[model samples]
Target: MPVTTQSWVVTQRLPDLLFAADARDEPISLTAADYRALHWAWSEAIGDYTRRTVTKPGDKLVAFAAIAELFQRTWRAEYLAGLWRPTLLQDLLWATNYEGRAPRPERYRAPSWSWAAVDGHVVASLLDDWLGAGVGTAVQRCEVLECEVVPATPLLPLGKVLSGTLRLRAAMVKATWDPDAQLPVLYAALDRLEEATLTSPPATSPAPELTQIGCAYPDSTEDACEIWAVPVLWNKAEKYAAGLVITPAATEGVYRRVGCFHSPEPDEDPGRLVWMLEQKKQEIIII
Candidate 1:
């Protein structure tokens, strides 16, 4: 038998790597790259915690309250359910990962835009990383006019949410369902392009051969009918985008987030998303 060495090792870098960049006494102030690493650590924790199977499904936000409280001291920012206010736009970019996931709870939890609203693994968008890397400059498409979250227990504000809503002004476009792929299609958006072409003809006739612009990862495929695509951030230089997929709520002008979608994935074209953004801008509420 080969000589075996008996040794004990202490991995000091284990937890340090996670919280080293985070601020303790003072708020975190670092270079763009370092700040992004800090955000990644927090996002990873949220992603892992959301995937866990719990005895009380309603305790989703409650379970993570301590962690949120801890970060609150350092972040010094308002906590909007599962997301933070400072980076709310990027935080809105989370999407449900339905692989081996259970159905959402019947009881009310958080709003549809929040990760706590769903029961499954979720991934936060990499838009911050992409921006920090200087890949492209981001032009915010959605203006977060107002946001509010009501807590179940006034004493434990961060524990459980009663109701939440976001008032926004963004470009909203209707999408049709694709029965074959079980996804939403932007067939109507092309009409805008035709209208623009007719009004102001370009030097060359622009014929866009696009059937499906980008992917729409809906929270519930069964209830994703009559959906709309709302592009939040558009990186024109790099040709990439990210936005929310929403459906109309019971209220006349109110909508609810069903899921989120990003562009330039595989064969998808970002130009189509750019076209979608040019359609029209409207002020709407999401709850």
Candidate 2:
């Protein structure tokens, strides 16, 4: 059995890790290398929890897994690559929060450090600002997102958005394509049940509504629509360079998927994971 180690420094805050780290008030400065380790750890942890469910609007509760996955793919991935830092963060913070506050905006006023009101989604918003940049290859690619997380339109900043209420039963509602036909369009509703209630399935069935989120990718309207679905299903999506996994569902045919992969299997020996992908890219073979 392979021992799952936290390869990401930024993303690796397990339930317990957060508590320990939060003990310190000041930022615990880490080197670039340390940050990458945290990023890998965080990605693995986030993927472990949020990979299972799909959520829709008016369904009850939003799919936190979807949001968590977005965060890891966004800032955590780039931070791991060592591409973003104080400079990148500075730019993002300025554009998103301090843009119009001209002429020593600091003197006049400023937005709260915590932009969120109800949900403590500061982590999510920070990830968005840092990761959401560029065009072409820079576009984010992941499944479940069916839309993109647009930064500008919301009334409150991302750091301070809410899912209405926490009292509502948590779950993903079903999605129907043709209402009369009652065709199942797949809304993979998995509840993040409480530890005490895992023994039983949800009491009320899911009744999801159709609403679009801006950050996720839109469904393909091309001849190769099914081909696009492949990228969404691939478990390890962030591994791809285009932020997309190029594959298609086939009955019994082999396909060549376009992608850049990191090392799938590391040496048994304990070593750094930063170069693991680059050094072991060729060693990884796609079935």
Candidate 3:
């Protein structure tokens, strides 16, 4: 084994700044640049921490309680499972970083919407390089109506969660399985995603010419013949939208997130897909 002396001046600055910002007594409204920087820092921390191999898969959230506590105190915001409440919508858009990934464990860890629900490297899609560069803004298209995360230990809200529920008011439409669909991005919710075909026809026409506008990256590899798409963010300039793919739970109108869907509607006019989605907006709960 060889010991190497490394320069640490540059590496120390990030944490120094992070803690300094956290030490503030009051939360300050951040500018676009500040927000980008903050988002980047949190994204890196989350991605780095979750990617590490752990002896017990169930210890995911439990192991990160310390960081979560710091985040809660700093932002003075609600912590939902593995995401922050202030940016819950954007945070819910995390996806797997590789293909042919393993299926989720049978034992419950976290809600399907949370990255802690699955094993592997998951990246926050909204915090990608494009957002950092400010190329196109991610317009939030959904609203989180209600959220609840019951911790196993009542004294430790940031510790292991017994259960969670996320309810949203957003545009949702049925998506059928399409094995022949192509994936537009390398990092998706799952390694092998089934093509998502819209079951409902577009408002513009009685019959839609193109049904394969997106793909569903499920949380698990189990067979799913049908799912639902709920649009979360839209970048009108880029003709792109990112959202969740869900399936109905035991209770009607309630669903479980099976995966995430990324739709790049380059062929359709900007806002056209959004318009279609708006027509089908409704409230649904995810557990």
Candidate 4:
């Protein structure tokens, strides 16, 4: 038998050799092309990693910082910071596909209202002005009682949040879901005076059509008819508002978010509207 070689190893850098460029002629400053490449890489990484990570609302900022660090050479600190708000909002609204059909996690991570609780890619409107341009301030205040995250390691890019508490100064009203329409319906016979106050001189015409709004649930299987809708503004100038849909949790007096109601014309004060609808006011909520 021919003598076998004790050991043999080979390695090749074909990609580097094939794609090598003249370093002397390379541009000194980063260009738009460089930025685009960096952004694409970062986005791809986030899309893949977030799908497998268990995220929480309170951990959003920290997660963003970690991702930014990976691309620091290509982006400025201020530019990265500016991306936070919109990213948070986008994650909250469209984090999961078939949201209604998604199963609820047995162990609590983030409140149902937060996008971080869901699993999937988050999408947002490109034209949305996240700097509070058309946004309204419906939430008067927020208090955090506790927020903790697991220590991150090389294997876990996103640390799991242990537990959290959040208190909100909001207004809530009773409502029910219309399965046929896949939206929560709030029926309030529009009072002539209220209609006149909210709308322009269409007084001569039919009373403003029953104020119908689009509503969505964080978990579609929620079957509580005695649901509460809390007013949260998405846009003030445009008279848009989103109602944080809530239901009673296992712990009495503690409410959990289930969905949201989008009102294109929330011209009326939410508190007053609740009163008009003959529903009790829920001033402070803890979750």
User: Best lDDT goes to which candidate?
Assistant: 1
Q: Assess every candidate by TM-score.
A: 0.79, 0.25, 0.76, 0.49
lDDT against the true structure, each candidate: 0.68, 0.24, 0.65, 0.42
| Candidate 2's TM-score | 0.25
Runs with alpha carbons beyond 4 Å of true place in candidate 2: 1-17, 55-62, 65-149, 152-287
Better of 2 and 4 by TM-score: 4
Give the poorly placed runs of model 1, Cα more than 4 Å off: 1-31, 126-133, 178-189, 192-210, 266-274
Q: How far is candidate 3 from the true structure (C-alpha RMSD, Å)?
A: 8.2
Error of 3 at 113 (Å): 0.9
**Candidate 3 lDDT, tens digit per residue, 173-278?**
6666642233322122221223445885435423333345465566556555567778777665566677888888878877888778776445543334543344
TM-score of structure candidate 3? 0.76
Compose the digit string of candidate 2's lDDT tens values, residues 83-124: 123222221111111111112111101111111111111111
Q: After superposition, how far is residue 13 of candidate 1 from its true place, in Å?
A: 9.3
lDDT of 1 by residue, 1-287 (tens): 11111210111212343344343545566566654665676687777766667677788888777666655654567999999987888888886665644465678899989888887777765464444335534554578999999999987888799899998888887665452343444443354345345667766656644445566666654455677878877766556667887889899989998777666453445354555656678897999
What RMSD, rounded to one decimal, does every model reach? 8.0, 22.1, 8.2, 12.1
